[model samples]
Every structure is written in C-alpha cells, then in structure tokens.
Target: MGVFDSHKSFGKAILYTCSAESKDFFKVYESSDDKNVILSPLGVFTLLLLYAFGAEGQVADEIVEFLGAANKRHLTDSYRKLSRELSSMDPDLLAFSDNVYIDNQYSLNNSFILNAYSYNSEADIIDFRNPKSAAKTINEWVSTKTKGKINEIVSEDDITYDLVVGLYNVIFFKGHWAVPFDESETREHCFLTDDFQLIKKPMMHLLKSLDYFEDEGAGVRMIQLPYKESKFKMVVVLPSHLNGLSMVLRQISETGLLHYVNRMNHSEIVINLHLPRFEIKSEHDLKNILPKVGISSIFHGDAYGVVNEAPVSVDKAFQQAFVVVDEKGSTAGAATGLHITYTSLTPTIPFKVDRPFLFAILYDDIVLVAGTLSH
Candidate 1:
C-alpha cells in the first residue's frame, strides 16, 4: 500500500475490528474488580497481523477473518500503510515500535523476517533460558519506546521455557490540549460511580467551541477534544444514565466506534465541559480473553510456521496500558506482547463527565487506545 492508495477499505476493516475487540475486552474488565481499564487495540492488532504473516492454513484464515481483512496480503498491506502514516507524525507527539524477539535456538524463516521488517518491525534473537535478563531487555525496549510511560510490561515470571517467540508493540502519545484547560478553573466535583456512590474528584473545566453530538437512539452524548499540532484527538462517550455504560458499549460493539464518531457532524458550538482529572493503569492476560472473541486457533500449536518449523504454541499473551488526563493534556502509553502467541461527547453542551464513561484516542479514524472509567 502506498500513500496514494485509498485506505478506505483498510480503515473500515481495522475500525470494526478494533471496536468489536475493544468492547469484548472492556466487558472482561467490567467483570473484574478493576475500577478503570485501558488498552491499545492498534497495538494488539499490529502484533496479530505480524503473526498472521507467518501463519498458514486455517490458522491464517481464522486470524484474517477475525481481523475483517480480505486475506493475509490485505492485513500486511494495511498495516504497512498505517505504520508509515504514524511514523511520519511528529516524534515528540507520537511514537510506535513493533518488534519480534525469538529464542536464539530457533531460526526464523528468512521470508518471515523480511515481511516483519516491511511492517516496521525489527527481529532480534535472544536467550529465553535466562528469563530475568530477557525480561529486562524487553522491558527496557518498551520503556524506551514509550518514553518511560510504561516501565515494565513483563517480569521474570512471565518468561517461560515454552516461550519461543515474543511479538511486541508499543505506542506512546503526549499532546497538549489545543485549548488548554485553566488549572485555576479545576475544582473538586462529585462523580457518581456505577454503584451510585458519590466520590469527590478533581474536575477540569473548559468552555469552548467543540464538535459535539447527542444520540437519542444510543442514549449517549459525545465530544471531541483535539491535541495541539496533531490529528490525534480524544473522544469521550457519556451515557445518559449512570449505569447505562453497558448498553452504550453494546451499541459500539454492534455499529463500531466510527458510527458514533461520524454522527458528530454537528457544527462546533460553545459548551461547558467538566471532565475529571483521572489516571488509569491496567494489565491483562489475553490468552484467556482472545479465545472468547473467536481467535482460538493460534493458541493451539498453530503458530509454528510463522516463526520456525518447531512445534510451539503461545505460552502467554499480555498487555499493559497507562493513561493520565489532567488540566494540561493527556499522556498515554501501552505495550502489548504476544509470547509466541498470539494473540463522548460531548461536549460542551454542558457535557459533564461526572460518571462512568467510555473514552478513545484516535488518529484520523484509527482507534489507538480505548477504555472505560467507572469508579
């Protein structure tokens, strides 16, 4: 795919995939005891696309189908174009890194290595026998790529002998608000939790002309907040009812996030915005979750051909994400690793995010990070 090639088809496929998968993952988070959740759909999608490049037979087909791609070629081509676009952005505002770490004992196929390179991924051979050192090396790479927002994605315990190949992706974004929120305007406000309990939180206040929409059909309101000097923006989706997040999430799962975003065509209007200053850090074991979403074949010894001829299955898959939103702006980062596995608003129409809601950071139409905050 070249810069001139139309990304419409590719963008549609990825947006649907990211939206569905994010909803599923968020459900898992909701079921857990965690109060807030964050994950990068693009990071996981990129890793899986890399794995699909080396896959064959039904395994490849299943992944391609799940990703809503026409086939393996479509998957890789779309990723290449997306990678190029992200890389062309200002490094200080956004950064992305993809890598494959193989055990020194296993020799990856030359074609697979080349294909990985074409997708903007680097391949390295490391010794998994020394789990501690391997963990440190991988963590160091993740930390550097994410500008220290994500310090450690893996520990010694996460590295096992069964792990033959580890596919990793990291995305970091730090952007000042196009219209900065005045710190003096921020004050303590009441936030209603899912349990109907009121808690005090530092709320950032702003009044400006912003793109906004209210969907009576979806029972939700949305707002878009742009980042300074970048196409990236944060969209917040707040449900009318305090406990109605699940219903809104189901709507997203069905129509995709793009559907609601496209509906934000209302002209920019002046509105009051009260958004809580919050931070979220979450980690997940995807081995248990991916299968629930119809991506089961890769975990059952079907990932060998993509890396080496040795019979190996994914031993572990993990993702850790962090996001902090304050008066200045938002800084977010996430790291997704497949141990051979593989894996709003608003707005301003008095759009006060004083309750549980959904949020996403997007570049153009691509969903980078998404999560729920219900505390």
Candidate 2:
C-alpha cells in the first residue's frame, strides 16, 4: 500500500514503524542505569525519507521496505504533504524542518535536489574536510530549529573525512495544557521504580475530563491530555502492576502503538490524575542500534546515488532529544543527524502514574516523541 492512500493510513504506518523502533531502542538501554529515555520517531523518519529520495539500487529498496512505502515517489510525496501540514501549524506551538549538507567535492543529483525542494528542505554545500567548522555550522542550525532545546547532535569527532552528505531533521513543540495543573497543587510524592526503589519526585495533580481507556486483557490504562488550542496531546500508558513496564512495552511492540491509541476513542471523563514533573534528555549512537532493526546496508557504502561524483556512505548517525513535562504543560524537541550516515493514560478514573510508564507526544496521528519513565 502507498503511504498517500490516506492520512490515517500514513500516520498509522509511521506510528507502527517508529513505535517498534522505539522498543528496540529501549532494549539497548535496558541494562544501563538511565531511568528515562526520549526520542523523536518523526524526526528520524523524515531524515531517512530524505536519504531514500537520493538512494538507488539495494539501498533504495531496503529503506523503502523499512519505511513501508510502495516506492520512492510515494514516500517523497507523502512526506511533502506531511511536511506542509506540520509547517502550517502555529510556529510558536510547533515547528518542523529538514536540511541536507553536501560536501563541495560532490554535487547532488538534480532529481534528488528537486525532491528535497518539494518538501521545503534546505540543501547546502559545505566543506567536509574541515570537520570542526562543518559541525559548528550544523549544530547552530539544529539549535536554532529546536529553539535551543537541543544544542548539539553532532560533534567534530562525528564528522569523518569520508562523509559526503549529512541529512538532518528537527521537530520542536511547546504547548500549554488545556487544563493546566495548578502549580500550588503540585507536591512531592513517592514514585516506585521498576526495581522497587521508592524515589520522591514532584507530582502534578489535577482532576479534569480527558480521554481514557483501560484494557483489562493488557493490564494497562491509557489517558490523553490535550494541549491548549491544538491537536497535540500527551498520551500516557500505565501498567496495572507496579513492575509491569516491560509487559506494557511488549504489548506495544506486538500489537503496535496505534492499536492501543486507537482504542482510546471511548469518551472523555473527569478523573483524578497524578503526573510527575519530569525532564529527560537523551543521546543515542544509532549505528549500533539501526542494524538490529534491519537498516544496515546504507552504512556499508551501499548509498551511492546521492552524490553525483564520488561514492559515499553513511559514516555516523546520531539523535539527541529533550523533553520537559510540568504543571503548566510540555516542551519537547529533537534533532536527528545522519553524518552521511545515517541512520497514557491515562486514565482519568483515579489515574496515578506512581510507577514506571510509557508516554508519547502526538500531533493528530503522528507521534512526535515517545519514551519511558522508570523512576
């Protein structure tokens, strides 16, 4: 099926694919000490779509299959529509952007450049020989796009000499809660971790009408908290068992995130909500993780159609994400860079997120950010 068949289908594809990828990402960090993780699937998907536009041979085939696109044309056209929709939003509330930095030594295919323009993506030629300067320029652009939420996604060390093209995508969102939690009502509360450790954290409480659902078979409850004057929302999913985060994640991986999210269409009702004020910033080296999800060919010099002259392959792929949820609302931003490489609830009904849970920020059907809070 083509991604452009309908917006619902396209969004569902994105959510399913990205949610599975997020599950894989969490597996990579399962053994680590970090208790919180955040990343933008949309941002990373946009970057890959851009790369696929210029890809040919097996590289193009692999990415198209991974992205679930019927063809490159369908992929590019769908992204163009998605990009336009995102850009039409109030800039102060949300912003989306993409860029391609090509080395001066090589020129981009005219058709690829045209496709980039079709999506309003910026393409610039820079000197990759000067890794430090290139990194600074790219970092500045990303910082500006994300409004400083993400200061850097790439460093000089990431810019290798063999790098030919660097693809980047960024998304920024800041919205006030439709029914904001009163700051005065926020209090320190005990949060039980997955390991049964009780940690005190600032918890924001509010009683309001919100979309909520419970899946007894899944042992999870979900809630959707909307943002002021926007379709954007924060969906939180809490497990019935205190240490059931892994079980919930497995459900998402097996049934798809859209499956659970779509079931939240019941009705809005007033419920007691207890959400913790949290800020999570995470950085990932995607080279090691991408292969686990079947996107490994491009890194091995399989990508040659992007540049007009010299053959090039992705050398590195990185993503840096930051998110903050408090009494007022949430502010989240992420930057994904392919250094050539590249890469619920709730619930209303007395919903208390006192344990590890999963969450996502969505603009309509597209998931902008997804992660987990374990402590």
Candidate 3:
C-alpha cells in the first residue's frame, strides 16, 4: 500500500513533488476571489509524502542521518530537548531539518572543590557518557543550543544536569481546516456560517484548464494547484464540496495520491476555492503531547531499546508551530525541539516569509512540506 493509504494525511506530501509544467496552476492562487491556488506536478508529490511521513519514524531518521557521526553527539543530545518541545505540540504532522554549530565564544570552563579548592577545564562536547556529569552538560548544552527552546535535555532527574553544546532542531505539523468549503464559483457576496451568520471573507475562484477530475464513485471533486517558484511544488486534493470534509478525509488513502496527480494533464475546468484566513501560533510544552503520539512510554520510562549499556531513552521533546493561510496563497511552518540525550531541535528556523505564495520541501519522492492561499 502507498504511504497515503494510511491514517496520515497527504496534503503536506503532494506540494513537495510538483514539476515545471504543472506549476502553472500556482498562478491561480488569489484570496481576493480573483486568483486561485495553483500547483505543479512536483509540488503535488512532495505534499503527498509530507502528509504520509511527517509523523513516521522516517523523518527522525533523515535528520539523524543528515547530521551523521560528524555531529551526532550534539544532535543526539539536542534531539532530547527538541523532542520535549515537539511532545507539547498538537499538530497532525510537521517537520523540518537544519544544521547546528557550537558557539566557541560562549564556551566557559568552571571549577569544583578539591579540599575547597579545585577546578577543571574539560572540553570536547562534554561527554554525556558520564551519566552524572553528562546529563548536566547535556541539559545546559541543549538549552544553550536552542536558546532555551528546550530546558532539560535529559530528564529522569539522574540523567540531566547543566552544560552547553550545539543542537539541530526539526519541526513537523498537520492541521485540519476548521471550516472546509467547497470549490465553486462563489458569488461576490458575504460568507456565512451554518447558522447563517454573515462574515466578510475573500473567496478564491479558478478556471483550471488541466489537472481536473470529479470522482463520482468516490463522490468528490479533485483539483491540483502548483506553485510558481519551481516545478516540484503543488497542492492537489479531493475538495469537500461533494461530501462533508470528514467523510472525504476518511475516503482518502495513500494510493489516491498518484491517481490525483498523474491523471491530470491539460483540461479546462471551473473551480471556486474558499478557505478562511487563519493565523495559528503555538508554544508547546513537551511534557503535554508526547504521550499522545506514542513516544511517552519510552521517554517517560527506563527504556528497553538498549542493551548492555546505561539506560537509553529520550528525555524531552517540545516544539512551536505556525501557519498563516489566506486567499492569495499559504505559508505553514514548524519548529520541533527535543532532547534525546542518547540523540536533536526545531524543524525550521528563522525565515523571511512574505506575500502570497506556496512552499514545500522535496527529497526524491518524499515531499515533506507544502501549503498555500496566503493572500
């Protein structure tokens, strides 16, 4: 079965896999009812993968592999801190990857008391191998690396103390639209809720000429919107017009991904996409959400995932996620900070996000991020 065939959503995975010719669709994005979110082939594939793998162990593996042995220790320790940050998040699936470096300038060596007068200056990534000394330094290094995005890299009280090191953070997220609307030619009128409440909202409308299909068997309408920046970037989906959003979501699976993107080529079609402009900002306390995603058992316990060595387990994982959606296009991002002690921080970093456009992260067939309608 394809990855999308599982419970994970494919929206994030599709956009990260669009192509140049398919990108023409991104030009359709317009929150003002003047433009609609368009996407290319590559964009669609990436989003699909992002949707399926965001929560899977694969993302974590990718980050670990990227860091390699060259920076594994720091990355591993920081992973614990970032994990706590991520545990606090409530997103469906969100992820990002980047590098972390030590700040030599901030390196400070302190002392101890050997007969009331002793000091030591040992530097070399502050070996956490020494549980007592290691945990402290790992915690300190974790806090130092993420600027305190993570506090205690190694929990368990016996595992963490305080020191300093570098950290690489990866963030991941996924959210369902609060109000999923159908795509049609919405009139230039006021938007109303199910209660018939009136509200002023910009609705995006489109007349797509290609990559359009209506699944009568599935009872839904599907369309693909490609981004303009590159070919491997787009958003494809089964619109909720035909059925309720929840029902439609249940009907979707991994295999449906390829069908949606591959079937579309060039065709004339009409589309009206209406999505709320939402600004979501979150600060997750790792201690809150980790147990929910199945990570609690290990991090909160004396893990058995190790042998013949010290107890190997996660310490903390937390994160912060943000996404702004509008008519012109959409922008979504996440920052996951964790403390693996035995392992990492934030999915994304400080970036310059402006205007209406779409973005995605693509690695071969796996698309890690994608979103639009940020008008």
Candidate 4:
C-alpha cells in the first residue's frame, strides 16, 4: 500500500452524506478555476470529521457508513455541528473555513458509475443544482471571515445536477508568513528527504540569534522563524530527543497546532531557519486505501446502493491537493468528495498513525492555513 493511501482515502466518507450522484459533488469542486488557496464544502466537511474523533482511520469508515445510512435529521445536525468544530483552529485560520454557501435542489441522475457528467448539458445542469445551503453559506462566510486572502467560494456549477441532493461547505484561505525573511538573506540550500535524496533548492535563511530553551518535561522544542512582514511567521516545534513527532500530531489536531503555537514565549534568542520554496500537488486514489481501514463495501465491485437518481453507483473517490510555499506567502487548494458508502456500527478507538513521519502546517496568527505531511 502507498504511504498516504489510508490517510488520503479517508476523505471519501464525505460522499456518504449525499445521494448516489455524489460524483457531481466532486466535479463541482475539482472544476474550480481560481488559483488561490481553495477548498469545497465537501473537503471542509471531510476534514471536520478528522477533528471530531481520535481514530482517524476508523472514524473515517464510520463517517462513510453514517453518510450512507444515517437519517436526514442526523445529517443536518451533523453538518451544523461541523461548523462549531471548525472553531478549534487559530481564530485567523478557522476564519477562512468559510467561503461558499448553497441552498437549492436538482434532478438525481443515476445513469452509470464512474460517469458524473454523462449528459451533454451537465455543464449547465450543475449551475442550477445548488445543494448544501448551509455548507455554501459557511464557505462564503470564510471569504469575508479571512478577508480577500481566501478569495472565492464554491458555486453551484461545480456540482452536477444529476445528484438528487447534496450540501457543500467549503473554506478557502491565503496568507503570508507572520514574519518575513529578507531577500538578502535568501540563498540556495540543500533539502534532505527521508529517503536520503538531496535536492538543491532556493532556501530562505534567517540568521538572528534568540533565547532558546528545551524542557524534557514538556517533550517539545519551539523555534520561531520570522518573515519580512509582521504578519509573516514560521514556527517549528521539534520534539525532544526521545519524543516522537507522530505522538504530537496524533495528540494535536489542526486546532491543537494553534493551541501549542500560542503557548510559545518570545525571547532574544538566536534563530537559524532554513526552508525551501516548494510546491507539491498530490492526487490520492481511494481504491486500495479504503479497504485497509475497513470501509471496503462501498467501492468494491459487488457494492450496491442508490446514491444517484439512476441505478448507477460510485466506483471510486479521487482527491487532488496542491500547495505552494514561497518567501512571499503560501497558497493551497484541496478538492474532495464521496465515491461510495456502506452500513456499519462501531465506536472507534484513537488510532495513532505515528511511525517516523514529518508534518509542516501553515498558519496565519492562530489559524491553521494549511498542513503538509511526509512519511
């Protein structure tokens, strides 16, 4: 199995919330043309699932089951509660969690699996099918919530009207580092990957000494990297000698990142921060990954359910995420929706995915703008 397959495919559970034609949900999301950091209501909702539990893998599976069989009343409440959970991130970060809002209905097409837009007029059909009013409203709120940085929200055209009904709640965000680095200080440096690959990249270096301290008691080491502007910032929390990083990520959700960020104290210590200007676009397929986590029935060849208007069913869920980090600022975009679902009941224990992994997340003040992971 691939490294992130389990983590990435967990996103497919978001599809369970809608009827059969959830592929139309993804079409609207993956089709956005804006270049700034972007996320659809579907993506945000799936991410929210990450926050409400401890065993991400199992919770993801349970979410998929709930999405498929749970009643509409439960779905409505769950959607509403998802927003409340979003507030855990930095107020600034959580603020971008709003951007688009939707409220409407449309036809449910079940023509065939793997074909979200089988009809010729689907281009116009999606524009008319405005589902998930609550989610769309929240996304729109994020745009104003984060200022112009977040930019645009998801529109109805993104969803295919072929789905009986669906809801969207998306958040888009863009922000510069709270502390900016001087151009004079920027130079080329080597970035070492986990597999021992060395890549020479335009690395930003800031050499300013400051007071530094480590407490074995706390199991964390905090370092602050400053950017040119007061709003620009980069803070790295390296674990103590014996402390594992996976432990930190498992204990800290996106909101946990913000919680620990604020606990840092400022002092006149020396800071030597070297980071690269890089861009990563990851496309995650849910086929092999979903089964490993126990939610296999939805996409398997023998799976059966009525999510769309026709007899068609989802065969797979595809997710694509793009991120760019530079001296000026950072930008990211994520698109996710459901491909399938099933029936199951189980309270998941907190499953830890810790096994020598690295994670770097972006934030504006207390808000977490983006999070990057490597294993």
Per-residue lDDT of model 1, residues 225-257, tens digit only: 988856779999999887888788877777788
Worst 10 residues of 1 by lDDT: 340-349
Task: lDDT winner between 3 and 4, please give it.
Answer: 4
Show where candidate 3 strays beyond 4 Å. Answer: 1-96, 99-198, 236-243, 253-259, 270-278, 282-311, 326-329, 341-365, 370-375
Which residue pairs overlap in candidate 1's backbone? 54-306, 222-344, 222-345, 222-346, 223-344, 223-345, 223-346, 236-344, 237-344, 271-348
Q: In what order do the candidates fall by TM-score, top score first?
A: 1, 2, 4, 3
RMSD of each: 3.6, 3.7, 15.5, 13.6
Measured with C-alpha atoms, the lDDT of residue 323 in candidate 1 is: 92
Q: C-alpha displacement of 159 in model 1, angstroms?
A: 1.7
Q: Is candidate 2 or 3 superior in lDDT?
A: 2
Q: Whole-model Cα lDDT per candidate?
A: 0.80, 0.79, 0.34, 0.38
Tens-digit lDDT track of model 4 for 1-375: 321123322222342211011322222222323211222324534432322121223343444453432433343344443344443445454332321111133233243211222111111122324445533643445345444443333344434444332222233334465555577777776544433455566767655553233446656555555444333354555554323543444434222343455566565555565656666654445444444434444433322222332232234444444556676666554544342222211221121212222223432332222333222
lDDT of predicted model 2: 0.79
RMSD of 4: 13.6
Candidate 4 worst ten-residue window by lDDT: 114-123
TM-score of 2: 0.93
